[model samples]
Target: MTSYVVSFPIRDTVVRSDNNIPWVLAMHSNVVSIFSCFRRAAATCRSISCNTGNDLSLWAKERVLAPYISSERRNRIERVLENRTRNVVVVLEHLHSKGNENAVYRSMDALGFQEAHSITADEESEAGQASGDPRTDAGARKWLQIRKWHTTRDCLLHLKSRGYQIIATAMNNRDNSSLPVQDVDFDNKIAFVFGAEKDGVSDLAVEMADVCCFIPMIGFTQSFNVSVAAALILYETRMRRIRMFGRNGDLTDEEKRSLLVEFYVRALTSSKARRVLQKYKYDATDSSMTENI
Candidate 1:
C-alpha cells in the first residue's frame, strides 16, 4: 500500500459561480498540468490521494468521473494517465469555509480533480457555515475544520493499521540535520501529514507523526506554505521511492483496482450530473468511506 500525496486545484465551473472564475481556473489548471506531467514521468507510483480545501468544481468533478465519462473525455484523461499508473485519492480539508472553499472549488475545476469524499465539521458549530445566496443557517453546512483534522488522523491510523509509518512535515529538534528528504524510504505505506497555512502542522499532527521532517531551505524564508510544502515533499518522496524500489515501491495491482473503484463510486455520486458508474462492478461491502467529523 505505498501512497503519495498530491494537492488538487479548484475547478473552473466552480469559480464561475463567483465573478473571478476564469482567471482562477486558468491558474489552477496550469498547476494541475505541471503535476500531471510529473506524475507521468514517475510512472511507478500511485497518488493515494490529494488534500484539497473545500470547493468542488465541475471540471474537478470531471476528473473523478473520468472512468465513467464520455469517450472523448475518457480518452483525454487516459492519455495523461500514462506514466502515472497509480490510483490517487483526493481529500478535501476545511474547504467548507465560505471564501476559501469557493476559491478551492474553482481551483479544483481548473485542476480537473473530481470530488470523492468530503468531511465537514460538526453540524451545530457557528463556523459550520456555507456561502451562497441569502446565506442563512440552514444547518446543512458541514464543519470542515474538524473534518480535515480527523480525516488526516484517520488516514494515518488506517495506514498504520496496515503496517505503514506516518511521517509529517514539521520543524523538529534536528532540522536539516536529520535525514535528507531524498534519503527517506517510501517503499512502506506511509502518510505524510501537513498542517494549515498560517500555522505549520498542528501539535497533534506533529505528535502523531512517527517522524517529523523539515525541508532544507537556504533563503531568508523560514518556511513554505502548507500546500507548497506538501507538493515539494510528495515530489521528493515519489522520486526517492522510484529510485530505490522501482515499481515495487508502488501499490499492488489489487490495491490499485480497489482504490480506483472506490474513487469512481464517490466521484460519480458527488453530484447528480453523472451516473455512468452505475454500470460498473464494485464490491458492495467495501466500507472505505471516511467517517464524517
Candidate 2:
C-alpha cells in the first residue's frame, strides 16, 4: 500500500517549533495527525477518529489556508455563505454542450446553490467539460459541488434517498403534465432535472420525477434556452426562499464556516500553493481511512 503525507504552513513569528520550521503531518499504515487552529492551538490536540477522516482533512486544509486570506475576502465569503443552500439542487440529464452546462453552473453559483448533479448516460465527458469555461464562468466551477452519474435512475434515486423532491423541467406542450416554475413550492428540498439540449428530459427521468415544472412562455418560442431556463428557475427559487426566510435564509454558522474554509482554500493561486491544495483534495478521499478503520 502506498502512503500519503500532508503538510501545511505555520506563521513563524506566531508559531514556534523545532528550528522554526513549518508543521508537517505524515500519515502511513494506520497513522494520522490532526492540528488545531491558531486561536486555540495551545489547548486543542490531535485525535484519531477513523470515521472523521474526511472532516479532519477539511479542518487541516482550512487551518493551513484560512489565515492567508484577508478579512475583507472572508467577509465576502460569509455574505454569500448565508444565502447558500443544500435544500435545492439542479440536475442536467445527458447535456452535451459545455457552453450550456457552464451557463447553468454560472446561474446556480449566482443564486447561492451549492451542488449540481448531472446524468450523462451517453456522454461521459460532460462533467469534465465544466472546466472548459473557467474564464467565462468566472471560476464558478470551484465553488459548486458538481456530481456526474451514469444513469437517470441512479441520479434520481440518490437524490430521493437524500429526501430531495426531484422536479423535472418539461416543455410547454406538456400542459397538464407540468406546472409553471413559479407555481411550484420552493419551501421543500427540490432537485430540478433539466434534460439534454436535443431531447429535453428523458422519459425515465420524467417518470421518476416527483413533479414536472415548465417555464411560462408567451411568445411563439416553445422554450427558453436550457441555460436561460436554469437561470430563471433558480432566480425564482431564490426569491421565494428570500420571501420565506429573509435574504440570508436558514444557513447556520457551522455551514458558513465550512464554506468559508472551502472558498478560502480555493482562493489560493500561487503554483506551489495550488500544488499543495491539489494533494489535500486528492488525499481527502482516502477510503482506507473509512473502510479499514
Candidate 3:
C-alpha cells in the first residue's frame, strides 16, 4: 500500500484515495458533475412551478382556489350550476319600471334561469353580457347574464337566428290566437317576451312574435304586473322543462366545466379570500365584483 493520501468529502463521506491521484481526481470530478446536474434539475423545477403559479387563466385560478373551497360551498355551486339553463330565456321590451327590470332579474335567478334579453330604450347593445346587477332590485340578481337590444326587432331577429321561437305575451283580447301561458308549448327553445302593463306589448313585438301567449286571469285585473308575470312564467317554465326533459337543466358537459370555474372564482368573496387569491397571483379586482342573489 502506498503512503500517499487525499480526502474527497461528499455528504460527509470521505473516500479514501489510497494514494491514486488519478482515481481521486476522477471521483471528485464525478461528484462535481453530479452536483451540477442536481442544481440544474432543482432550478428547472422552480421555473416550472413559478410559471404555473403566475398563470391567470380561469382553470389556473380554479387550481389555486380548489383547496380553499369548503365542501359545502363547492357542492352548493355544483347544485346551482346543475339547475341553471341558457336554453330558455326572457326578453323585455321597453318596460317602464327599472325596478321591474331588477325584479325580473331576481325572478330569473331564483328560477335557475341563466340568461335574459331586454330591449333597451336607448341605443345600446345586447352582446357579450356576462353579468347584471341593478341597484333597484335590492341586489337580487345573481351572476345572471343579460343582453340588451336597442330595438324589439333586433332582439327577436337574434333569438330567431339562434333557433329560439319568440313567444310574445299580450292579453288574450290583443291577439285572437293567443294561448294561455300554461297552455303554450314550453318544449321548444323559447324566449318569452313581456312588456310593461301601461303600454302593453309592442306592436312590432307582436308582429315579430312566432306565437303569442297571455297569462290566464280570474280577478278584476286584466293583466299581472310585469315582475309578477316573470316570476310566474319562469317558475312554470322551469317546472315544465323538468317534466318534459326529465332533467333540471340542459347545459352540456363543456358548459358545466366553464360555469363551474366561474362559480369557484366568484366564491372567493371575503376580503380575507381576496388576500388568499393574491398569493396565487389571481387578479383581486374581479373579486370586488359581487353578484346579487
Candidate 4:
C-alpha cells in the first residue's frame, strides 16, 4: 500500500465526534486524491494507506471493545484485515526507549499517527505471562523484548518478504551518496526505518536497507533526533509521492478495510486512552468526563 501524509483542514472537535462516519468518509476522499498522485508518479507503487491521529484514536476504542468480543472472532477479523492491507506498514519502533512514552506519543500525534502500533518490551513480557497459547504468546514476546538491533533487522526482513524495499535514514555512505532523501524513488513498496537516540541506526539496519538516505543539514549538529528525522523523511516522501503521482498512489478499497481493522485491534487500550485524554488536557481543553470517569 502507498502511504500518504494527509492534511485534513477540519477541526479536532469535529473529527472527534461520536458519529465520525462522515468525517471518515471525507478523509477517505482526500486519501483517494493522494493515492491517485502516487499511482501516476510511481507506477510500481503497490498499495496506498494513511496514518493519522484520529484513526489511531479509533484503534484505541477497539482495544476497549476487545474483551467484550469473542477472542476467536476478534482475532479472525484482525488477521483478515492485517492481511488485506499488508502493503504499507508504518512502525514507530524503540520510541519508548527515551523513557518518555508521552514524548513519543506527542511526536506521533504531531505526525497524525494517533493509532500507530507501539510495542514495548514490558507490555510483551506481561502478555507472555498471561496467554496460554504458545504461538500467540511467543509472537508477543518477540515483539516486546527483541534486542534493539534485531528490531530493525526483523522489520526489514518482514517487509522484504512482502515485497518492500527497505529505506533507512542515516549519515550518507559512499554507495548511498548518489541517492539522497530527495532522490529516493517511491515507485516501489518501501519501508523507511529510523533508529533510536545516541547510537543512530545499527550497522545491521544500514546493511539490510536497500537504500540509505541523509537529510542535508546546515547546523553544527551532526544529526537530528530519531523522531525529527522520521517526520522530515515521512513528509518528504509524502510530498514526492504527491508530486510524482498526483493523488492516486493509495491502498485499494479492500486494503483500507483491512488496515483500519488491524489498527483498531492494536491500538485500543487503557494506556492509549490515558494518552489521548492527557493530550486534550495539555492542549487546555476540558476533559472532566475523561478524568472523572
Candidate 5:
C-alpha cells in the first residue's frame, strides 16, 4: 500500500492510514477552518482510493471544503470570474511610485485583466501598496497578481515565452511608427508596457516591443502620466475586446473553474470565516468530477 500526501503550509499534518491513506491532512491556525473539514470527511471517504496530490487537493477544495462558503459569496465569485480575461497583461518599466502601480492594478481589476509584470530598476524596488489617489486598497491589491522582474530583457523574454505581443507605449515624438492606442489591433495576447514618471520606457523596451502605441492628444501637454496612459490603453483594449466578442470577458471553462477554486479557498481561509466542516455532505456518486482533475 502506498500513501499520497497533499499539504499546504505543511505543518501538523495528521495521516490516518496503514495500507492506504484515505486522507493526508495538514491543518494550521490560519486555514484550520478549511483543512479541518477533511477530518470528518475522511470517515465517509475512506473507501476513496489514493489520489495524487493535485487530485486530492482539488477534491478537498471543491467537495469537502467549498460548500462552507456562503451562497452570496459564491455567486459574486462566479460573476467576477465570468468577466475575467487571462490575456491582456500589463508591464511597468522602472516605475518608482507604489501609488502609481497600485492605481494601475486597480484599473487592471476593473478592466478584467488578471496579471501585471514590473521591470524594476533594481532588486530593491517595492512597487506595490500605493497610498495615493483613486484610494488604493491593500486588500483589493491581493485580488490581482503583480510580478516584478529585475530587468527589462528578463520580463520581456518571459512574456514572449508565454506568447504575449509586447505593446510598448511611447509619445508620437519618441516613435514615429507607433499606432494610435485606440486604433491598434489586438490580434494576439498582449502585454501593454508603460514607463516611469519622468522618463518613458527603456531603449530595450522599444527595441523588443512587437508593436508600439500612443494615446492621441490635441492639447499642448503632449503626454499622459504613466498611470493615466495605462488606464487609457487598457480601457480601450478592453472595450474593443468586448465589442469584438460581444461580451466584457472571455475566460475559458477550465480557466473559470481554476479561478473559482482559488476564490473559494481565499474566502474560506480568511480570518472572518466562521462555520465549516459541515457533517460530511459529500456525494460519492459524483466521483467522476475528481477524475477530470
Candidate 6:
C-alpha cells in the first residue's frame, strides 16, 4: 500500500482518500497536509491542491471592520493593544521544531512582545514554516509580526539599521563579552536570538551579535528548553519595563487605532466584513468632506 498527501487552502481542511471520501478537519493557518491511502493494485496517483491569496494589510482591513465589532470585543482588543510593544524582539535561528516555534510565539504574546525574527540558512528546509502551525501556536501567530530571513548576517544588518541591538543566547559567556540576562538593560531596544534546539546559537549569529547573553542555570540540568528560556527572558524584560516605566510599554495611540480596525476585521465573517468595509469607506469620505467645509 502507498499513501499520497494533498494540501488545500480552505480554512476547513478536507482530505479525500482513495475511495474519494472527504475527511473534514478544523481550520488552521498554513498549508494543510492530508494523507490518502490507496490499495496496492493502484499504480497511479492523483493530486489536489489550492493556493491561498496574498496577505492583506491589517491596517487596511481594520479600517473596514472597525464598526462591526461588539464593544466587548473592542475592549479586549484594546487591552491587547495597551500591552503590545516592539521595544524588545526575539530571533530564532534555524529552530527546527514547529511546537517550539509556536511555543516561543505564545511566550512572546504573553509577555507583550510585538515582533519576532527567524533565520534559516538552508534553502530547502521546512524550518521556514515552523511558525505556521496555528494549532500549536494557540492563535498567537495572528497577534505578532514574524519576519524570516535567509541568513543571520542579513537579519542582523536589517535589525541594526532599525536601531536594534542584537543579543545572542549562548551556553556560556566568552571572556568578558557577554552579559548576564539579569544585567542586560531592558530599556534599550534589543533583539535576542536563540539558536536551534540541539545546536544552541550558531557561530555566525554569535559573531554578528552586538552582545552575547545567557540565563544562569543551576543543578544537574545545565539548560532550559528553548521555549522556557525565551519565556523567562521575556518575563524578566517585561517586569523590568513595568518597574522602571510604571507600566508595560505600549503601542502608540495611532497604532492602537489601526490594530483595533485589524482585529475587528479579522473577527467578522468574510461577507459581513465586505459590507462593513464598504460602509467604512463611505464614512471616511463623508468625514473628509465635512472637514474640507
In every candidate, how many clashes are there? 25, 0, 1, 31, 0, 2
Reference-based TM-score of each model:
0.47, 0.73, 0.70, 0.46, 0.71, 0.70
Find the 10 residues in a row with the least total lDDT in model 5.
284-293
Model 1, 1-293: lDDT tens digits are: 22233233434311222221121123444676655544442431212122233323323334445645456644543432222322222233334335433333333323322222233456523564334322331211221111233355675565566565666666663333335556555656555555455665555556666776778889999787554565566566555655665632244455334444444443343333343322222232333433321
How would you encode candidate 4's per-residue C-alpha lDDT over 185-286 as one tens digit per residue?
778876666665776656776788788878888899978877567667756765666687664235456444434444433434456544654453322122
lDDT of 6 by residue, 166-275 (tens): 89988665566777798887777899999899989988788888888888877898788899999999998899889989777577786666556555655665576565
Better of 1 and 5 by lDDT: 5
Q: Give the TM-score of candidate 3.
A: 0.70
| Tens-digit lDDT track of model 2 for 1-293 | 21222323433313223322333333323222234433233322232121233434445566667666677887788778877887888998888777888889888888888888867754466436536486556678778777767888888998899889989999633446688888897768899998888889988888888889898888997877789989999999988888877762455676656666667766665566555655545332222211110
Q: Candidate 1 — which residues are off by over 4 angstroms? A: 1-72, 75-155, 173-178, 247-251, 255-293
- Candidate 4 matches the true fold with a TM-score of 0.46
lDDT of 2 at 50: 19
Consecutive 10-residue window with the lowest summed lDDT within model 6: 284-293
Q: Could you tell me how far off, in angstroms, the CA of residue 147 lies in candidate 3 after the best superposition?
A: 1.5
Candidate 5 local lDDT, 87-191, one digit each (tens): 888899888777787888888888788777867754446433223345753444555556767899998998899898988898643548898888787768888
CA RMSD per model (angstroms): 18.2, 9.0, 13.1, 17.4, 11.6, 20.0
TM-score computed on alpha carbons, candidate 1: 0.47
Error of 3 at 133 (Å): 7.6
| Candidate with the larger TM-score of 1 and 3 | 3
Estimate every model's Cα lDDT from 0 to 1.
Answer: 0.42, 0.69, 0.70, 0.47, 0.69, 0.69
Give the clashing pairs for model 6.
62-261, 62-262
